[model samples]
Target: MRKNIMNRLPVILPVPAPPPPAHRAEPVLDLAVPVFNEEADLEPSVRRLHAHLRETFPYPFRITVADNASTDATPLIAARLAAELPEVEWIRLAEKGRGRALRAAWSASSAPVVGYLDVDLSTGLTALLPLVAPLLSGHSDLAIGTRLAPGARVVRGPKREAVSRCYNVLLRCTLSVGFSDAQCGFKAVRRDAAARLLPLVRDTGWFFDTELLVIAERAGLRIHEVPVDWVDDPDSRVDLLPTALADLRGIARVGLALARGALPSGRPSRSYAVPVTVMALAHLLLYAALRPAAAAQAVNALSLMACWVLAQPVLGRPPLPAPPALPALAARLAVTAGSLALLRHAAPGAGLRAELAVLAAAHLSLALPVAVARSARGGRRCRTGSAAS
Candidate 1:
């Protein structure tokens, strides 16, 4: 019986099976070093970065050299470094803007966290881990190494420092931006956040950082600031005046867009009582001041019109979803006329004091709800627009 069973199984033969597909781990970080024409600093900086990352970095990483239309030997040096280092890569772009290079490199990378630092490596490498850790752990959507932050140590001349401070102040006053430093080169963004933001950013030059931050803030994304020890690179090729002028132009454009409600925000709605009260007080004061000089009807009409004009940018136009522009204007005109009529009727026998009081109260009661509704609408629009984008 044993012999018969062995004969029955005689046709079976052992055949080799193919090996399973290899599982390759994705890189956790892609640090881009964008350069225009830094042939001399390219190799040394990359080698130093590679060494630092290799020694202390806790995860897999890659160093990308983004050469943006370099006329010298930068491309050659970058290629040589990429060839020498397994974790290094090079990308050559036809354009010359740091923003363009960074955008291209980051968009092409598959890493979960993509970041770029100045080729000069003016920022201390010790901050590298802190800069990316928030993004990796999902504690923040973006992280920036801020030289202006309180704990930061910065070494730069008086002129550069003054310029930096003044620029930031201008941003606060004009754009109402919350970020401390917008021009810092040491910045990182999660790939998902970058995908949503990069399309909305219009600047392809030095102002790119500011544009990115402004849009991100408007979209209600959380930004993490890391104080860094930084040394100014004396060999930097940036022209101060031209760059400043360009940045100002960019600011003006962005500010105008924001005023027109063209740029949307993602922040939650807040109590409108304070702003509404302030506007009401201001409006009352304006009417009182003009009451003695102008006719009652004139003063009332002017004050109401002035309030509407001033509030257009703050509360936004078409505060409610109503009819077309012509009809809206007509409705506003009618409302203003009715308000004046109501004021006249309320104080027909009383003095100017009584009339002004009645006028203020009536207008406040009517405008407060409108203002609140407008604010709420604006907030909703911001969230909706951000989501759609």
Candidate 2:
């Protein structure tokens, strides 16, 4: 019996180990610099930034120079610096633009917080501490040095300053983005914030700066715009007129997006749903009552209902499959039934018309639901994201 039991020994089953618990490592702060043809500027800027980092930062830090397809010694200079400085990381992108290079570099960094400052360092290091402190303290997710921030000084030209003011005003009117200096090249982002932002951003040139800030603001990230001491670099690459024109066009794009109620990051806007629904119902009822057989009227009614169904799903409401037929017909029938019921109590055509008009107006009133939902969603989006827009 013992021999038989030994021979019948069963195979051992290996127990699967549970997954290691995810450790939330403290976020490391990283400094990113965008380089173009500034071989002359790179070394001096690196030295200055190194000095600033040594003097101020107590945490582990890394400096990344994103070489934007430079045709000069920028990459070589960066490599040399990286070799000498353990904290320095050199990133070379084949794309030949400051914005493109910066995006690539920022993406490559594993640090939880990252930011870009101009190679010229027009904004002072003193200002940078305040800008990044909020992020370090966990009070903000992003920081931007604002030249136009209240009480900030510009130790340079008044003409360019005037132009900046006018440009901001134009942006305010068009995009409704509320940044004091959206054009400021000095900006920082928390890793999660950057992850959400960089993908949605498409502009790879100078316009990238504005577009990024716009997207950040809309995403509801807490962006602290620190007032900074700014001095214009004598060798600035920006062409004011052309840059402004491009930014204006960007603002126009922003306006168009807003009109369609498209936000940069998050779930679709639910505010337009009820208004769209009301518009659809109104069109159908109006067509049936006035021009029932008109081709244009039928088309308009059908189009409105179709738009409503499409919008309803986006607005967090159930969608009707046959919107043009079922939803539209239902609205029309409701109006017709009401109008007929009222017609029996008064004048032939007058009472019916009045009843239809009142009903249409009541249907149009559903816009309030959309407005409230949009406002609440916008507020939530802001609290969770960045103070960018």
Assess each prediction's global lDDT (C-alpha) against the native. 0.77, 0.66
Evaluate residue 235 in candidate 1 and report its C-alpha lDDT on the 0 to 100 scale. Answer: 82
Which residue runs of candidate 1 sit more than 4 Å off their true CA positions? 1-24, 268-389
Best by TM-score: 1
TM-score of 2: 0.62
What lDDT is obtained when candidate 1 is compared to the true structure? Answer: 0.77
- Give me the displacement of residue 144 in model 1, in angstroms: 0.3
Residue-level lDDT tens digits of model 1 in 94-122: 76899998898899888999999999999
Q: What global local distance difference test value does model 2 have?
A: 0.66
How much does each candidate deviate from the true structure in C-alpha RMSD?
18.9, 18.6
